[model samples]
Target: MHDTSLYSSILGLSSQWHIANAVLDSKARSLRLDIAARSCAEFCCPVCGGAAVRVGADKGCWQHEDLLNMRFHISAVIPVTLCKTCGTNRISVPWERAGSCFRCMDNP
Candidate 1:
């Protein structure tokens, strides 16, 4: 997990999410972090709060505050969950609000 935990903590992530991989493009001046859910983790339906199983994932990218004067991008495999009662739903990422593609930044 080498330095990944550091990035996770910087990103304000919890146990459910972790940094799977990362790339720093100094030439392009950007940092991209790939995020994934814990494999053995169980998810609940956002609508019904019932137990849900991961069916698949959707690739998504969102811009975060710049890091070291370079663009910071958070890329994640957003989980698609199957709930018996609610059918299918896309689980929300901790960094972003539902249906948005931008990470929420702290106000100071």
Candidate 2:
């Protein structure tokens, strides 16, 4: 079993989300963390305060700080929601900005 807490802390992730899996390749010297949402029912529209429905996911990876001297990538199937008022919108992530390739969890 892998240490979820370690990755969680490394990524500064909330308990609401957890690392679904992590792939480590010695030859490639890379670590990829697959993140999954704990619950979609609690998600709300960014523009409106109304409940949203999951339409699909946007699969992408964000470059992360080096871990154990290996290049790290934090990947996720970020939920795309259909808001009653906004039509369709991407869910805001906690680790990165609304639209960015870099993780801004520790950044001000």
| Model 1: colliding residue pairs | none
- Clashing pairs for model 2 are none
lDDT of each: 0.78, 0.73
Q: For model 2, how does the per-residue alpha-carbon lDDT over 1-108 read when each residue is reduced to its tens digit? A: 467787787667776577889878889898878898776445678678688888877776677556678878877877788997899987877767544445533333
Which one is best on lDDT? 1
> What's each prediction's clash count?
0, 0
